[model samples]
Target: MRAVIQRVSHASVTVDNEITGSIGAGLVVLIGIHEDDDEEDAAYIVGKTTNLRIFSDDDGKFDLSALDTSAELLVISQFTLYGDTRRGRRPSFSHAMPPEPASDLFNRTLRLFEQTGLKVQTGRFQTHMEVSIHNDGPVTILIDSADRHRTRRG
Candidate 1:
């Protein structure tokens, strides 16, 4: 599993001209799943995302976790995160998990978040989605279950 987490003042997902999910003063999470993903991956990601200390403190230091501050989450499935174009003009999605498995993991992942007591909103899976975001501090981070490297202070 992989995710691009963006701290946003507001974000929303629209499908077929209808708003599917929306949030305010929270994080917009773009999620990707691979073939090898499982419950452990979902649990790991859920723990990391909610506990990441990205928000500001009273002294303006980035020291508050989303959980501590009660930030909402807007999750959107994005298979494109695995796009690989190193070999051809067209990007290949060979590294991405097949839709059936990926969507299953995606749904499970979101459920884990909700189970953790965080308010979670979700985009329609496998649908054409348009996202609108007001990125706070333009703060963005890439998270991967395999990659130990973490972006931003979170």
Candidate 2:
């Protein structure tokens, strides 16, 4: 599993003109599940995301985590994150998992985040959707489940 995390002042996801998920002063995470990904990847992401210290601290350094700052999460499923364009002009999604597996893991991850005592919000998986993002600090981070625990100073 992989995720593109954006620190946002606000973010929202709409499906069929209905708002499925929305948040303020938090992270908008675009997630991708590969064919090889499993529950451990999902578990890893929940921890890394909730604990990520990308929020500002009192001194204005990258010193506060989502947990520390009480931030919300707007997680959107994005299979296109695995799109491969190495071969031709068109991107291929052969590297991503099938919808069934991907959706299963997607929902499972949301449940896991909730179990961790975080207020988790999510986009409609396998649906036609639109999203709006107001990025804060334009701070973005990419997390691969396998390397989720690596410290910045590492």
Candidate 3:
């Protein structure tokens, strides 16, 4: 599982001219599930996303976590994050998880996020959607669960 977390003043997702989800003053997380990803990967991402100290504090330092600020979250399923373009002009998604299992993990991840007691909104899964984000501080962070696990083991 991989996540691109962007701190945003606001964000929204639209599908077929309808607003699917929206949030204010929080993070917009784009999640990509790899073929070998499992529930543990999802759990690791959820914990990291919630505890990340990307938000600024009184002295303008990055000292606040989403949990500390009760920030909202806009989660979007983004398989393209796994696009491999090392070979040619076109990108290959061979590393991405198939739709069925990916959707299951995405939903399970959202459920876990909602349990955190903060406002959690999500983009429609397996849909063509347009996402709008007003990035705060233009802060963006990328996290890969596989890399995290590898680092922990060593």
Candidate 4:
């Protein structure tokens, strides 16, 4: 599983002109499930997303985790994260997990986020939706379950 986590002042997802999910002062998480991903991968991502210290402290240092700030989360299923464009103009999604199992993992991941006690919102899966994000600090972090060390703070 891979996730693009962006700190946001606010974010929302709309489908068919209807708002499906929205959040304030939090992170917008775009998650992609790999073909080999499972519950463990989902768990790893959930832990990192909630605990990563991307927020700033009073001294303007990156020392506050989302959990510390009680930040909300906007989770979205983003299979396109796995798009392989090495070959040609067209991006191949062969590395992305199939929709059926992928959706299951996505839902499970969302549930894990919700279990964190912080407010959690989500985009509609497999739907044509528009997302609005107001990025905070323009801080963005990429996380991959396969690359555990990359997400760790020294």
Ranking by TM-score: 3, 4, 1, 2
Off by over 4 Å in 4: 149-154
How much is the lDDT of residue 66 in candidate 3?
99
RMSD list, candidates in order: 3.0, 2.3, 1.7, 2.1
List TM-score per model, in order.
0.93, 0.93, 0.96, 0.95
Give the candidate number with the greatest TM-score: 3
- What would you estimate as the lDDT of candidate 1? 0.89
lDDT of each: 0.89, 0.89, 0.95, 0.95
lDDT of 2 by residue, 1-154 (tens): 8999999999999999999999988889899999999999998887888888898888888988888988888989999999999998999999899999899989998888788676788878988889999999999999888575566673
* Preferred candidate (TM-score higher): 2 or 4: 4
Writing each residue's lDDT as its tens digit, candidate 1 over 1-154 gives 8889999999999999999899999999899887788888888888889889999999989899889999999999999998888996998989989989888889999999998777899999888899999999988988888864456565
Superposition TM-score, candidate 3 onto the true structure: 0.96
Off by over 4 Å in 3: 152-154
| Model 1, residue pairs in steric clash | none
Candidate 2 collision pairs:
none
Candidate 1 residue 3 C-alpha distance from true site, Å: 0.5
**What's the alpha carbon RMSD for model 1?**
3.0
